[model samples]
Target chain A: MGLETSKDPFLTRVKQSEKDTFMQKSVAKAQDAQWDKREAARKELGHWQDWRNLGEQIRQHVIKYLPDYLEEFADNVEKRGGHVYFAKKDTDAVNYITNLAKEKHVQRVVKSKSMVTTEIDLDKALLKIPGMNLMETDLAEFILQEDDWDEPTHIVFPTLHKNRDQIREVFQKLGYEGDNDPTHMARFAREYLRRDFLQADMGITGCNFAIADSGLINLVTNEGNADLTMAIPKTQVVVMGMERLVPSLKEAEVLDNMLSRSAVGQKLTSYCSFSGEQVAGESDGPEDLHVVILDNGRSNALGTPFESVLQCIRCGACLNVCPIYRHIGGHGYGSIYPGPIGAVLSPVLDGYEKFGDLPFASSLCGACTETCPVKIPLHRLLIKHREVMMDKLKTDKAFNKAIMKGIGMGTGDPALFQMAMEFDHSATLPFVSKKPTSVENLYNHEGHITHAPSMAKGWTDVRDAPRPPKHTENFRRWYKDHEAQKGETTDGE
Target chain B: MKVVVFSTCVVDLFFPNVGAAMVEVLERFGCETAMPKKQICCGQPTFNSGYVADSQKTMRNEVDALLSVDADYIVGPSGSCVNMLHEFRMHLADDPEYGPKAEQLASKSYEFTQFLYRVLHVIDAGAELDAKATFHRSCHMTRLLGERVAPFVLLDHVKGLQMIPLPHIENCCGFGGLFSVKEPEISKLMVNEKVDDVVSTGADILIGADQTCLMNIGGRFSRRNLPIKVMHIAEVLNSNVDMSRVRYANEEELAAMAGGRD
Candidate 1:
């Protein structure tokens, strides 16, 4: 389950998520709350569009010269007594990291939240090693770990789907009896995580952005668990998506300002730490630093129309604004990555065979594009994915293609369109409601179309579609008659 | 001004009153309006569904029809359709024949309210509607066309109409053309949420710039027997008219309106 989080079909997952009213309510509440925070944060910074322009330029410049910067980053890291490994795929990343764990004879591993590691299925791979103990120190990730590794519904707030009661139940499994108060649960998790921090020999954390000029891993978290994870463990591994790097601290600082603001509406996360291989002068830092840059099919988007998708800072702002995500939740996407960004990225990383439906999940609302801090054009990329799948991949159904072909023919020729307009009322009248309804004024004929046959049943099932007026009363004919009357009035004048 | 009306297919068939209201409103502004009979759909049904090659034919037919008339401006009742014309430049940029024509079409085209407020310099349409209403800002119009200010300002000037600020006005109404049918379950959930927001407003009428959105949101309101009437912004502006109060932006007001999106 590298990228794929659930084996359930997309609709099945949607059906399951639909039953979780709590998740839906929570997602809505979180989105509305975050909307104010994010807007206020941007407003505080002033000239948000200009800042977004700067953020986009920095990401675009780095993406344009990605390979050169990666090499520079690797060289600088090596010079600082750090080992660098570029994993082309998830398996490669997992194998390299697991091998390093074996080489170090690691027994206890304390981890911080890293989506890249989850993307590569690193946790399960590490768990396979005999007597290896891994604990997720991030508050949300720890809650998910305790709940039998429930998949994350959101990027920033991983356990957002879980309520205080569910979290209390998860914490009770670790042998503590307490009320469902959030503070009590957090303290319980903190105490439990601190014990692991003292005993842990290795720490794994995700890099928010890797500074290339001066090789350093930047980690931003509201909780200071990442600092503790790096500080307590002798050996540390910093895993990152290959695109998560800037040319220098200057650019990283710009993005850090944006990421914190966009991600959680913070001026800066509680802990914005930059670290590398332990220096001789430093008393407390990792002695052995392993940097793993995982491509994991990110290169598939390179040189494609979708290359801009790599501009994502994983802010999950797209999800917060997405109507579809609000309804179906993250599991409905059936990928480790979800929402608008996931819709574009999952198919790129996984291919159309498994993730084809994700792109069409959106209404192409453009909210994601407007909200994106780095301006990924998430909605446009989703359309691009659809185009690739239907046109190039030829994965769409023949029936849909035939229907679309009919639409093309009907809309393309005015003669055909006129013929359809002539028959519109007569054609749909059969499905029009026989008895007048409360909203009878909405339809001039019997009533609104309460029921329809064929493909239109989808529309009729949920709502009453207005029946088209007769050809005699249609707009074109009406406009013609009105124009004639206007000519007469002008002549009289 | 001679304005060519792009009476979108939805308005031509399902909601012709919206087209009539738009034409009437334009006439009231003292502009000669012409509807290109050859114009039909904007090909969004197929284009957004990913039938790019097939949709191109429909798009080309639209560009040809909209350009058939010699007019100073081309305007439509639907911002969504207007945005489609704007995107014609992107879709047909490779075509040697229609590319320039598509660009020309985009340059002249405007959404109905946008044309009234921005192009014609309208500050008030002098229409009265004795009803409380909330506006649903359709996604394509507000976000894609970037015409957020026009509808609100024009609506604000509608005499005797008390407007309520809709909750989550930024959200889509789940009428993404083919998306409503292709993924109806998700669409249902989204529209249900939209209906709830409108219902919560306690407004008797729902007004939106795009008929497609009004069709979806109003259709659901009818289906639920909610008794909430829906009116397109064009119809709202073309309501009971008081020509004496009709006003246009003066030079100072024009400068203030300059900051609005193109």
Candidate 2:
């Protein structure tokens, strides 16, 4: 499920998500709760604008010299006796991780929360190995794992759609005698997953920031499962999106502070660890560490106008502010990278034709841009995707193309524009007359269209469309009357 | 000062009265207003939807028509449209002809309150309205155009008006031009939430600089028969004119519209 969670058409998937009232409520509640906290946290972390500018500068520097950084990072990893694999595609990344697991003959794999692993469909690839057993160490992931590998709905809180009762139900399957409470469920999960952690032969984690100077990978989490995952296993594999790197721990530290504030409104998560290969005398750490940097279409964005998308820190701040995401929820996007970041990043990775509707899913309200810790101009990038799909790819439907073409011609000529305005009301008169001319009743005689045509039924379903007022009822007519009465209108200067 | 008005296509056709109020408000500030008849749409509907090549044609026509006016400032009642005027430069950056004109015109183009507060330095337009009202901050106006301080400053000086802060006022009303129709379910949820936020403030009149937002949020308000009046910022500023509330949908009229029909 590498960002391709839904094969259904975009509208169909949107409809499915819209019908999920529980998910919608959950998203809205989470957003409201996080809004004030995020605001306060950013205010507390003084000079938020300066901090954002610094964060943006750091990311821009890393991305501007990404090739050099990658080379330096790989070399540093090699110096630490760790292997670095640059995977140009999802399959390339997946094969490398699974092949490594196979080489070790690792039977039990315990994982921390890693979206890049999900992007490469790593769990499926690893599970394909014969007799391999895997468990998600995070509590949310464990609940989803118990519920039959349910695809995560959010980047941070994957099991946001599940309630306390649902968690208890999933927990009961593993012989837990606890009430339907979060603390109770977490305690039971810890007891249950501890055995897997101790027995696990392989550990897989997603890198939040790959510090190039030190060859260390940073993992930030509220659950602390990541710390356990990195320390427990003899063999460990770190999956990272190629752009997730900083020059050193200094840059990583600034980002970690910002990420905590933007992600969950904390000063920091319960665990923010910078782990590298095991020291020679270390007692418990992976002797063999493999870091796989995945391109998976991210390289497609590196040199384009979309290069800013790689600056995203996966803080989920955009999702918290997204009004559209509040209604349709994360699953509405039908991608592993949900909400604003998903809209921008998905089309770049999955091509415009495959994910054309993803860009159009936004209201372009710019909330994501405002709340973004790294200031990724998420809405502008969404518009860029639309332009790429329509103007460059010429992938928009012919009907829409024709209408837009007509708009171009009509607006370009003042004569045609005035003519259209004069006749627009009459042209729409039949629809708005409400005389039961047709059973459809697209419009009411009150001059308001109650229902839009099928292509635009979404508008009419929620609100009424005003009939274009004829003659003096329009603004031009009102302006004419007001100006005539004033007798003071000027021509140019 | 000479002022050229960009009465957006939405106001020109559906809400023409707004254009009247805008002119009146501008005149009160000792500004002469010019209406460039060659104007039509701002090319936003097409540009936003990604028809860059076609939208550029409309944009070039607009940039040329707007440049024909000899005015000190170009103002529109809408921040979204005015911001698009600024964006015209970006759209035509590759074009040798319109690119420079786009920037020249965009530099002078301002949203109504933005023009009033920033250029004219007039906070109160010497008009009064007796009602509790809350202003909806259009996403483009506040976040895009960076016109936050102006609207609040002007709304402050309105006589006999109580300005109550809307809860989560920064949230969008879900009127993304085509987005209202393209993603209707999400659009409805957002507007309804906005309506709830508005009603919770106990304000009878909802004012905003952008009517695109007012249309979506107001349409839902009218449909729900919430008795909340929606007015463009221009109308609120032209308080002496005694204009009626912009009716999006008359519930009684829509209900009785089918009356006595077979």
Candidate 3:
């Protein structure tokens, strides 16, 4: 998956998705199930707001002192006989992991669900080394792997947009002989993955939260894949975003609760494994352990307005709640992280030249922020991204120039604003299908007329652009005219 | 009680009757209502479109217009506008004076039903209208303002009115202001869903607090030529207009009604 998906006109994708009634129905049903489960879980948790507040506090505290905690975490990991490598960028991360794989002469690697791995394109990176084989151990991820390395639509579900039939087709393509039933498919995949898990030379997993004090990497999974991936493999490698660190086990517990509830509406996942450095006399664990803490532009966010974005736990709750994500689905985001978090993070990690349009994808409804477990202020970050895109980077130069002119004119002169309004009101006449108030007129105008010069193509390409009323008779003007006709003085303080 | 009216740009322009109705309703509740003369737009259109600087201009204009008023409360019939006032105050963070002014403006502003129920403590205005109506809970109001209870409280008490609750009332009617025009197909899909919910209610009329939303739903109602009358809740409550004998028709009736010019 590439950032070009977001560059595709939103209208085209929306129309395509709308046409896919089957996919739409599946999405709607899944959304309903997830929403109900989430509601019930919130109610069961009792004082869900308190939980959210605690989650936010823990994340905030962690982000606030990330550097210190990271150092402490590294120290603890070293003390426990684990090696820690801090990578400032994707190259650094890939090089570190590849070196480890080469040093161990790792022939086969089994991986659990790790978005960070995808972010760095680690699988592709690792495949460059001769005689290296990477296998996805998660059932959904394995399906993705089997399906010619299809990008995940959602961070948590991975293949959520794919129906059971689609999964069956993928399984069939992979030469699986099993009942098309979901349970059977799952069981078949499980039996297949269990063998790979047992024989894998290395286990690579994403850390949900790395506890600073004890040097523990917390991994939450509904499938016992992570446990198996770590258990049987001779060498283990954990890759985590640097921000995925907590001060202690107490914070880890809070985050674990938040992550489970937010991701899949569970009190806790089936497997909540906390692994530290390789210990002596440990029988069922990897002999060598390497923790790669990848910065990957996250360090740039610290002390910025978007610092809160670092607080995201990759729970994918924001994706589940986003209206845009629900409609176009996550593949449209063209990133490992999709939906609201992806919209904010993609442009920051990647340059806006590629993902500038991502920020504009949202309606800024604040739903993501409202539902966010760590209170990342997802919408605010979207806005901040726009600000930076427009003012600082000037990624969309033509659009920004036009908007700046609009800003100047809109703010500089009330007369100019009124004039523009007047022009707009009158301009509606040509495109007006029935009357000014008619939906047909609005839709027609929206589709036909290009209102704002730059980026009008971006908007008008998708939907009817409603013309703003150009009448100078604003509320104030109307009120003045009415009072003048009545010869009555206005009452005010 | 002194109440400042933030006649949202939509009501002030296309649907002036809604504003007139708001004035009458508030007056009946003993509110000394005053429309601030300098207020223009709520800045939401610019703000939501990622034109923060342009939105701030509009916001600054709005703040300048309303800050002088010392009303007990500022009330608007538009949930979107009220929500913008309350929620977008943070955008003014860079401007110290205007930032606090925006917050102060937000604090005084309430969606009409919220002001009526919370501020005026008037559940039933003791006024009556005869119509079977379903309420469309504007998403911004319900989710952003958290004013879910106020509209129900006020509507429950309207004498001679049969209130049928709309199914999926929380779903947006897709009048996301410029969103309807910008993303017409998706907007149509959303509004179509809303219309289905409205039609399923089997009510003769669809009532909402925001004129922009009502206009969007109303336009769809008209386009489809559904026999559903879309009216602002303010118009429904304040009208005292008996609809028992009114026979609804297609283009002819609408033309006649427009010609009658009441």
Candidate 4:
């Protein structure tokens, strides 16, 4: 249930999510709520596109000089007396941290929510260690943990599919008694996690941005749980995707501003901090700091057309505007990254065979690209992914390819297409009906095709397709008559 | 000036009145207009579906057809298809010949309102429309084609038309051509919400520049038996007929609607 959720195929996943009315309603409502707030937050900075350009420029620079930045960032981290482990594979990352925990005789482990952790299945890996207790401190993460690890539905708001009552039910099983009010649930969860924070032997957190010049990691949260995750533990491990590096604090701050605004439409999250290993005099920071930089197929995207996916700040702005995501929810994508970014990034990470279908899920409405703060041409990338799947990676699409080729041949020739158009009416007219009638076991009824065969059934299943016109000759005739009448009348005038 | 009008497939077959209106409007604006019989679909059906190599045929054919005509401007009633035509250069970037031809066509091609306002600089075509309308800014037109202001500029000078902002008007109408069929559930929900916004505006007519979207929204409207009339802005602009009455969707009423801006 990590990257590949169901393995039930793409359309099946879409069907399952479509049937979840509650999930559909919640996502729609969330998208509607996020619209104005994102706009207002973006508007707070005058000439927001300038900020986007700056953001894009900064990310583009970092990704282009990634190795250099990584060298400088790792050097600075070690200079600050921190350990840097550049993990080329997820297994390397998992083994390094699990081995460290074993070496320290770690008993109780706590973690702040991290998508990278989910990507590498670090939780599952850690749980493999016997005689160790682990907990997810982020409230949503904790709830999911308690529910036996229900997958996250969004990047920023992970438990988007869960309602307050469902949460109350999850918490009630942990010896809680309260109404479905969020405040009460937060208070109870705070007390519950506060006790664990005290006993937490090792704290692991996700890095939102890693400032390369200073070797510092930045984390943003509303509950300040990440601050606690860093402060309370003697041993802290920060897991970050390799692409999360910013050249310096100036660029980091710029992206931080954009990320906050784009992620949750906030001026700033309640807690935004830059932390490194324990400073010489610092009493509260982690005595032993480990920064695990996980490549995990990111370098695969480095020189490709998908290089801009590395530009993603994980703002999830694309998700809020995506129409398909609204109906199918995050689970439909079957990847930790969902929406426009996921459609582009997942195939880049996992290859096109499994994740190729994700790209086609989008309508290519350009909404995602328009709202992107970093100015990623998300819609175009989606198309590019489709191109790679169709032309390069995929071998089983010959039928679809043949069909498209045939269409191309038809449309490329005006005479052929016009002839096809002429005969299409009689071909389709057999299936069309004037109204839903008693004597019908067929494709159409009531001036619409209610049911259709083959791939066309996809549409008819949801909405009725309009019938083709009975006569096509009248338009050309009308054009001729109109031209003649206009010629005659204007000549007289 | 001579104008070659590309009546998009939706216009050529389904809604000829809209095409007729566009030609009449351009003609009345003192431009001689003609529709070439050789033109066909924009190949978006294949191109957008990730068949760019195959869709190239339609793209090449389109470039050939439009380039065959010698006109001051090549205009079309569809923002989406015109945007597609403008995209031919990018698609045919490898062609030594068609690449330059694509650039030339894209430069000369414009959506109808775009040519009217940007090139002709004619905001008012001396046409009067007596209807209260809320414009659905189709995604391709406003966002992709960057013709956000031209349609509104033209609508502003109509003799007797009242316009109000649609709530979250930038949201898409779920009519991504093939998307309507490929992901019908989401498409249905999206268009339904778009219709809700149109209904919320309380405008009698829902006007847009693209017929694909108009048809999608209008189809849903008719299916639901909603009382709103869907129209192309070209038809509205082409009308010089005297109005017996004008419909209204006032600022106060707009504000009264749920989710309205102050």
Which structure among the candidates has the greatest DockQ? Answer: 1
| Candidate number with greatest TM-score | 1
Candidate 2 lDDT, tens digit per residue, B1-262? 9998898888876776578788888887789888888888889888888877778768888887777888888999898999899988787888787888988988899989877776666645666889999989999878888777778867887778899999877688988988887678678878988989998999988888897888788778766757677788888888863323211214553343232111
The TM-score of the first chain in every model comes to: 0.98, 0.94, 0.88, 0.94
Rank candidates by DockQ, best first.
Answer: 1, 2, 4, 3
Worst 10 residues of 1 chain A by lDDT: A437-446
Model 4 per-residue lDDT tens digits across residues B1-262: 9998887776655566677778877776678877788888788987887777778778877888887879889999988899999888788888999999999998889999888776666646666878788999988887788777778867887888999789868678888877787777667877888888888998988888998887677766655656667678888887774333222334553343323100
- DockQ, prediction 2: 0.35
The residue-by-residue lDDT of candidate 4 on A1-493, one tens digit each, is 4566668888788878878889988998899999989999989877898999999999999999999999999999999989999999888999999999999999899899899999989898888788888999999999999998998989988999999999999999998998999999999999999988999989999999999999999999988999999999999999999999999999988999999999999989999999988887887889889999999999999898889999999999999998878878999998989888998998888887779788888778899999999999999999888777666655535766666677678777877766665665566666564664221111121265557665566665554455544444434445777899989999999
Model 4 CA deviation exceeding 4 Å by range: A394-399, A436-454, A467-477, A489-493, B124-133, B156-168, B195-204, B221-228, B240-262
TM-score of each: 0.98, 0.92, 0.87, 0.91
Between prediction 2 and prediction 3, which has the larger TM-score? Answer: 2
Scored by CA lDDT, what does every candidate get?
Answer: 0.89, 0.83, 0.74, 0.83
lDDT of 1 by residue, A326-396 (tens): 99998899998999999999999988888989999988989999999998988888888888878777887
> For model 3, how does the per-residue alpha-carbon lDDT over A1-493 read when each residue is reduced to its tens digit?
3323345565566677678767555665676678778778777888877888888898899889888999999999888888899998888989999988898898899999898888888888898999988899988899999999887888898888788888899998766777679999988898877778877899999999999999988999999899888788878999999999999888889889878888899999999998865587766777778899998888778888878888899888888777667666776666667789998988777767667667776656667887898878887788788777655565545755676557545643456655654566565556444433323222322222333344443343333344544365444455556656545554431
Find the 10 residues in a row with the least total lDDT in model 4 chain A: A437-446
lDDT of 2: 0.83
lDDT score, candidate 3: 0.74
- The residue pairs in collision within model 2 are A475-B16
Per residue, candidate 2 scores C-alpha lDDT tens digits across A1-493 of 7778878887787788778888888888898999999999999989898999999999999999999999999999999999999999999988888888888999999999999888888888889999999998988888988998887888888988878998899889999888987888899999999999999999999999999999998999888899888998989999999999999999999999999999999999999998878988877678889999988898899889999999999999998988888887777788888899998988889886667788998889889998898889899999888888889989877877887788778877788888877887777655553422211111222466666665556777887666776854666667666677667544432
Q: Against the true structure, whose lDDT is highest?
A: 1
